[model samples]
Target: MNKTGKIYVVGIGPGSKEHMTFEAKTAIEKSDIIVGYKTYIDLIKDMLEDKEVASSGMKKEIERCTEALEYAKQGKTVSLVSSGDSGVYGMAGIMFEVAFKDESHVEVEVIPGVTAANAAAASLGAPIMHDYVTISLSDLLTDWSLIEKRLHCAGKGDFVVCLYNPKSKGRQQQIQIAREILLKYKNEDTVVGIVRNAKRAGESIVITTLGDMLKYEIDMFTTVIVGNSNTYSVKEKMITPRGYEL
Candidate 1:
């Protein structure tokens, strides 16, 4: 009987090897096949030499995960790559779901990496030193009304909010709506940090107020962090005090 192969869900972390965790890299190195979105695969293409690569475009996540599972069942070690932490809006969940439903007895391991929130926060100093919530404005799978409710709750709770997939060409108004919803609870002067292409090429960091964040350029590659009431900006760095009584 052939041994069932293993699958490793690896997070690449901000499209740069420097930001990727050692474990993530190791899984890719050990895998016989690497599968991921084309953009993410390109980010680490150099390391994938002599390896079988299966890449697809956006919205093909289900196809990608299914392919990885198929490869694993065929006794091939597979690495499913995702940008940022795999468990955070990445491929890990879908992979597990597919595996469970199919009852594929393949060994699976999830290797975490620097998620967008962490990478964006580090780029603009510590804006989430206290309680925070990470929300994605993309309504691809989630309902818009549900997202609004989450935004409203995050605002009312005064939790530092990290927004992913803030905007894109076809979906532009969601970010604006998010800003308006957050403004209902957060003051106009609340610090907002925007980090684009974080830890990768063409990286840009903006420290602005929630009232003026929309004025700056934002897109899918950007991560926006809205500071809590206690958060502030000093010397161009956004900081949220942890209330250590200093």
Candidate 2:
């Protein structure tokens, strides 16, 4: 039989087995080897206990992809895992980049999963119901100035904004900067919802206002959802009506 020299770049979704898709599970079940970030692999340690696993740390993305590709080239099925949707800030793009540059002929599959924005929105009770835009405050690969420009546009358009990587140890001021820019276009009372570790253990959900958003603690695990000009907070929910009139 011809070797199934293929690599599956799968999204496991929010680090919970329940949130993981059947397609993702099946792909990993079929794969002979699995490679991903150490945190991601640890999330499913029990499920992948018997599989040949190669785990990488925070910044070694290229090395992880290269290892997966090399394993596939040896006629082994490899599942390269990512936390959220493989296409969104995940390993799928990296795998494709490596594959194209090296002209590797291995078959590649990309599976989608829930991203932090969507997961946090759901936990916050539909803050993303209206027109919304997602922006990551992390400037590792993107420039802070460009991110600020996008924030400005979202503010002018009154788009509900979902922010990823709001604050980390090294970069702590971007969230405050984002709030300042949005305040120019949005009200100080605009509703804001903060979700940390969505759908995972020790998850935390906090509802705040644009005026006092900075008073709360934020980190890489947190996702901040800012409502549009029309968004409202009632009881325990942050909701943006989809312009449907009763």
Candidate 3:
């Protein structure tokens, strides 16, 4: 609550009212204006119908934040909501870049929410409890070569890899390519968990080995968790539980 104005870059979690955190709910309830992508706004439409709302299309990340800033300049409490935790492949970083680049903006605070990583982990049963790393499969901003390099490194390091944006129409094979890269260091029997629409109404969680991954079709709503050598599956659940017994 600073004089420059206040912007709450809020994360709404994975498209579910029950999964949304209390703090995130409180922030949304208190906000004077809610700005976000159209689908996300529609997801929480009932709670925000009375509030001033502004929504953008799928590919308008910067424009969305800029529009939120304009609302902030008017001394309105603006909430720029993201689908998952703002820090993890969400809108927080971009909003920060916009604020810093422009300068002289409102107080931007990122209120955290359950990300796909957390949701996927929960769905599949603690596959990232120990040392792990997260990577995004989208090559829109990053080069696929760099993604391959990182995938190789993560595989070599035996880190549990949480992957975001695993599959879309344009980049369907990116995850398959990453699986091939990881297979070099891992095994054909290495456990992998695919959680689609995690925590949402139509959520589905699948646990299979690396060899079976090609048979499964993923989407943008899916978050893929590929286990390390130490990880395994039990009763069809991919688990990387803390090594307490060992």
Best by TM-score: 1
Error of 2 at 212 (Å): 0.7
Best by lDDT: 1
Give, for candidate 3, the lowest lDDT window spanning 10 residues. 1-10
What is candidate 2's lDDT per residue for 1-246, written digit by digit as tens? 446489999999998888889999999999999999999999889898789999989999999999998898889999999998889889999999999999988999998998888889888898998899999999999988899999999999999999988999898889999999999999999999999999899899999999998888789989999999889988889999998889
Measured against the true structure, the TM-scores of the candidates, in listed sequence, are: 0.99, 0.97, 0.95
Error of 3 at 8 (Å): 0.2
- For residues 178-227, write the lDDT of model 3, one tens digit per residue: 98899999999989999998988888988988899778869998998999
The 0-to-1 C-alpha lDDT of every candidate, in the order given, reads 0.95, 0.92, 0.88
lDDT per residue as tens, model 1, 83-200: 9999999999999998999888998899998999999999999999999999999999999999999999999999999999999999999999999999999999999999999989
lDDT measured at residue 238 in model 2 versus the true structure, 0 to 100: 90
Query: Model 2: residues >4 Å from true position, as ranges?
Result: 1-4
lDDT of predicted model 1:
0.95
Error of 2 at 44 (Å): 1.0
**Ranking according to TM-score, highest score first:** 1, 2, 3
